[model samples]
Target: MKVAIVGAGLTGSLLACFLARRGLTVTLYERRPDPRVAQVERGRSINLAISERGLNALRKIGLVDEVMADALPMKGRMIHPVTGALDFQAYSASGDRAINSISRGALNNALLTAAVAADGVSVEFEHRLVELDSAVGRMVFATPAGKVSVEADVVLGADGAGSAVREQLLAEGIVAENVDFLDYGYKELSIPAVDGEFALDPGALHIWPRGTSMMIALPNPDKSFTCTLFWPAGSFDALTSASGIEDHFRINYPDLLPLAPNLVDDYLNNPVGVLGTVHTLPWQAHGRTALLGDAAHAIVPFYGQGANCAFEDVVELDRCLDDTGGSWARALPLFEARRRENTEAIAEMALANFVEMRDKVASPVFRLQKQIEHTLERLLPGTYVSRYELVSFSTTPYAEVQHRVHRQHQLLGAAAVAAAGVLFAVTRSRARR
Candidate 1:
C-alpha cells in the first residue's frame, strides 16, 4: 500500500520508518524545510523524555544506540523548593533505571534520516497539507513551486496538535474534535553550561515547584539545560523590564538565578506556548485515513509521555496492520479501537501529574507516599508497581496501568489503616496491664 504521512516531526518520521520496514511505500510530507539544511527555529524546542516505550520504537528501527549517544540519563527529579532546599526523588524503586533526556530536534532529525534511508520511504520538504479527502485518500499540498496533489492507499496524520489534516477532516465532518485548554501556558528559558560543565546535576530533571507556577529544566547534550516555565497565561506581562523579570525569578525561583545567566533575555524574547488537551473521537476516517500522536490526542506534558505515547501509537498501528493482513480498511478501525482507551488514560494521568508536579511534589505527605510506593515496589516486585513505573518503565497498556494503580492505592490505604488500628490496640492493652 502507498501511505502518506503528514508532519515530519517525531511521530511522523518514526511512523514513516515503521511503515517502510513493512515493505509499504511511504511518503513523509513535512511543512518545514529539511532540518539537515535549515536553521532550527529558536526557543521552540522542549526537550523530550524518552522512556522505555520510546526507546523500544527506536530500537525497532535500529537507531536506539545512535539516539542514546546524544542523550543524557535522568535518573530522577531534583526538586528545588522556594526555601532553597533540594530533594531528590528517584523515578524507580531500583534506582538504576532512568529516562533519557534527548533534544527534540535531535531525535526528529535522527528519525527523518532513518526514514529517508529506508528502502520504500521518501521525504518531501516544505509540502504543507492544504487539503485532504480522507474518503478517497487524496491529498493536496501547497509547495514552494505550486500546488501538488497526490493519491494514496492510506493517509496518516501525525502533523501535531494543530494538524491541518485533522482540521480538514473536521471541516468535512469526518470526525468530531473537543479541545480543553489549560489556563496555564509555558515559556522557554536556558541555563547554559558554566565553565564547560553542567551547572546543575546532569543526572536529574530539575524542578522548581511553586503553588501555581512551576519551572522544569532538562539536560541537553551540549552540557546546557533547557528550562521551561509553566505559568498563568497572562503572567509574562508582569515581567516587563529586566528588573521585574529578575525580581520574579528571585521571588519564585531564587536558587536558579545564578544558574540561568540568560534568564532575562530568554524570558523577554521567547513566546509563551499554550497548553491544551485535544480529544478527537474515532481517529480513523473512511477506512483509508487515520490520525496518530498529537494530531489525534494532544495532552499536557506533565507526565512526560507526549512523545513516548506518540511512539507507542506508531508501534500499535504497525501491530494493527499485521493483525488485519496489511488491509487499511480493517486496520484503521482496529487501531483506533485498541488505542483510544489507552490514550485517554494517559491524557487523564498527564493532567493529574501536572498537579502533582506543581503542588504535591513539595508536600511532605506526597514525599512520604512516594517513598512508600517505592518501598512497596522493592518488596513486592512485579506484584506492586508505582504508577510512574507502569507508565514509563513497562509496556503495560495505559488503561490497565491506570486501573491497576487505582486498585493498588486503595489496597495500600486499607492496609495502612489496619496496621495503625492494630498498633493502637496493642498500646491500649499495654496501658491496661
Candidate 2:
C-alpha cells in the first residue's frame, strides 16, 4: 500500500521514517525547496524546547541522540522582576529533569535525511500540494513541470496551521476547524553572546515580567538567547517611531533597553507573530486522509508545548499503525478518537498557562499558590504531580493529568484553611495567659 504524507516538516518526515521502517511505501511532499539547501527562514526561532513528548517521538526512530548532540538543557524558569533580585524556580522537584533546546531547522533536516535513508520512503521537494481528492484517494501536486497526480491508498496531512489538505478534507465532510486568535501578539528579539559566552543565565528560561506585557528569553546552543516580546497588538504599532520605541522600552522594560543596544531596530524590523488556538474536530477523513500535528490541533506557544506536542502526534500515529496491523482504515479513526480529547485538553491548558505565565506568575498570592502546589507535588509523588510535570516529563495522558491536578488543588485549599485555624487557636490561648 502506498501512503502519501503532505508537508515534509517535523511530523511528516518523522512519520515517513516510521512508516518506511514497517515496509510501507511512503511519498513525502513538501512545498518549499529543500530547507537544507535553501536559505532558512529568519522569522521563526532556529531552536525549540524538546521535552519528553518530543523526545519520545524521536526515540522511536533512533534519532534522539543525533538531535540532542547540539541541544542545551534548561533546568528551570528564571524570573526577572521589575525590582529586586531574580529568582530561580526549578521545574522538577528533584531539579534534575530538563527540557532540551534544539535547533528546529537542524532537526527537520535530520528527520528528512533519516526518512530518505529508509528503504520504502521517497521525498520530493518542491512538490506543493495544490489539490487533494479525498473520495478517490488521489492528490494533485503543482510540480516544476506542471501539475502531477498520484494515486494513494491512504494520505496524511502533517501540514501546519495553514493546511491545504485539511481545507480539502473539510469540504469532503470529514472534519471541522475553528481558530481563535489571542489579541496579544509576539515579536522576536535577539541578545547575542558576549565574548563567545552567554550573556544571561544559561541554565534557565529567563523572563522579564512587566505586568500586562512580558518578555521571555530562551537560550540557544550558540550561546545566544532569543527574546520574545508578548504585547497587545495595537500597543506595538504605537511604538513605530524611533522616539516612541525608545520611550516605550524605557518605561516598560528599562532593564532590557541597555542590555540590547539595538532593541529599537529589532523591535521595528521583526515580524509580529500572530498567536491563535486552532480547534479542529474529527481529525480523520474516513480513513483516506488524516491530519496530524499542527494540522489537527495548533495551540499557542505560551505553554512552550507547541512543537513538543506536535512531535507527540508522530509517536502516537506510529503506535496506532502498529496496533491496527498496518490497516490505516481502522487505525486513523481510532487514533483520532483517542488522541482528540488529550489534544484539546492541552490546547485549553496552554491557553490558561498564558495567563499564569504573563500575569499570575508575578502575583504574590499566585506565587504562594504555586509554592503550595509544588509542596504537594513533592509530598505526594504517585498520587499528585503538577500538570506541567506530566506534560513535560512523563507520558501521562494530558486529560488525566489535568483532572488530577484540579483534585490536588482542592486538597491544598483545605490544608491551608486547617493551618490557618491552628495558628488562630494558638494565638488566642497565649493572649488569655
List per-prediction Cα lDDT, in the order shown: 0.92, 0.84
- Residue-wise C-alpha lDDT for candidate 2, range 1-433, written one tens digit per residue: 8899999998899889888888999999999999889998765766678898888888888999999999889998888887777888778777888888788899999999999999999988899898888877789999898999988988899888888888988777777889998889888888888889988888888888777788888888889888998898777787778888878778766667766777778888888888888878888776778898888898888777887888777778778888998788889888988888888888999988877778777777976766766787788877778777888998788888888778877887898899999999999999999
lDDT measured at residue 360 in model 2 versus the true structure, 0 to 100: 75
**Model number with the top lDDT:** 1
Please list all clashing residue pairs in model 1, or write none if there are none: none
Give the local distance difference test score of model 2. Answer: 0.84
Q: Report the error of model 2 at residue 159, Å.
A: 0.6
For residues 218-266, what per-residue lDDT tens digits would candidate 1 score against the true structure? 9998899999999988988888999999988888889889988888899
The regions of model 2 sitting more than 4 angstroms off are 418-433
User: RMSD of candidate 2 to the true fold?
Assistant: 2.0
- Give each model a TM-score: 0.98, 0.94
Judge candidate 1 at residue 326 and give its lDDT: 87
